[model samples]
Target: MEPDIWGIVWLSLKVSAVAVGVCLPLAFALAWVLARGRFAGLVLLDAVVHLPLVLPPVVTGWLLLLAFGPQGPAGRWLEATLGVTFMFRWTGAALAAAVMALPLMVRAMRLSIEAVDLRLEAAAMTLGASRWRVFCTLTLPLALPGVVAGAVLGFARSLGEFGATITFVSNIPGETQTLPLAIYSALQVPGGEAVVTRLAVVSVLLSLAALVVSEVMARRMGRATHVL
Candidate 1:
């Protein structure tokens, strides 16, 4: 691969990894709430959590820009208070990817949490375990497979994110130009088909690898849960 292609690959990996890292805890908490909570507006919260799945990627990107752009309310506040900015930066690209990937992560985790036997949690609670302790010792252990699956799904989604990323951060090479953006950029130039093809192959391979790892981890977790 060309040095440029390597840079794109590295950037894509770094961005996706960062996005998933940032999203996992939040996604897990949301999934737990959706799977177990019965508060009012639960349905509304679920819809909002999954809104990106139904909305156009570009639309989601536009919303993100409006909310996180340098001049936008949240963006302005962050910048003014902390001297942090995301506009047209690699961090912005990661944020966009995280938004695009969040629904998948939440869905996987919710399903997994829902599948956990409530009896086990109840039994642990009855044994004088605090809710947090029970969750750490019982619920979370049983949900590990699902969490892993969700992380893999989010990572794969982030790796392929294009419209949101480009709209949120633009295609600046060595900065925000991730794998998908690199491929898109390559396609615009004369005799760039080779570059596009190479990047496409890399993208496909990365996605496939993530899926495979997720499947294997899920299966292992399933087997372990059954044994427990």
Candidate 2:
């Protein structure tokens, strides 16, 4: 392995973890709203949530840039108020990754939430649990398998996200340069074939490991739920 391999691996894991961590609770809330709420424009909201799936990655990156670039509304306000900048930074990379993974997260969480038997939640309420408590104590636990699957998949996707990362964060090494970005950069240089090949192998291993982990987690959650 190259001396930088460990650094690359660590960077990928940290960025993907941050992306999933930031997206998970928001995904759960959105999923809950979609599953249990009867609000106007919900269909529209769902469409917006799923839009990134259908949109090109480069286009999504551009949209993120327009919304969160240093001079952009949200980014500018944060810079002025908090003295933090996102453009071309690792945080920007994570934000791009989170956006790219959000659709999958929402879909998985929403499906799991919908599959939750409302009758069980109602039964908990009949036993005098409040709605929020019922969700925490009964419904959320029931759908944890899908949540774990979704989070793992999102992390895997974030690890490979390239166009969005490059467009948003510009591939600064040891900064915004994730595994995919590092691989892409290597491919653009003369006699970089060996490094690119090694990175590709690393990418495949990481993705495969994530998949296996996710499957095991889902199965474990399913078994636990059954045992309960």
lDDT of 2 by residue, 13-98 (tens): 89999999999999888888888889899999999989888988888888888888876898888888998787878888889999
**Local error of candidate 1 at residue 62 (angstroms):** 0.9
Where does candidate 1 clash, by residue pair?
Answer: none
What's the residue-level lDDT of 163 in candidate 1?
Answer: 89
Q: Model 1 off-target regions past 4 Å?
A: 1-3, 222-228
Q: Candidate 2 versus the native: TM-score? A: 0.93
Quote the RMSD, in angstroms, for model 2: 3.0
**After superposing candidate 2, which stretches have Cα over 4 Å from the reference?**
1-3, 223-228
Q: Which ten residues in a row have the lowest lDDT in candidate 1?
A: 219-228
Q: Write model 1 residue lDDT over 1-228, tens digit each, in one string.
A: 343888899999999999999999999999999999999999999999999998999999999899999769999998999987999899999999999899999998888899999999899889999999999998898888878888988999999999888888899999999998888888888888889898899998998898777777767665522211
Q: What are the lDDT scores of the predictions, listed in order?
A: 0.89, 0.85
Per-residue lDDT for 98 in model 1? 95
TM-score of each: 0.94, 0.93
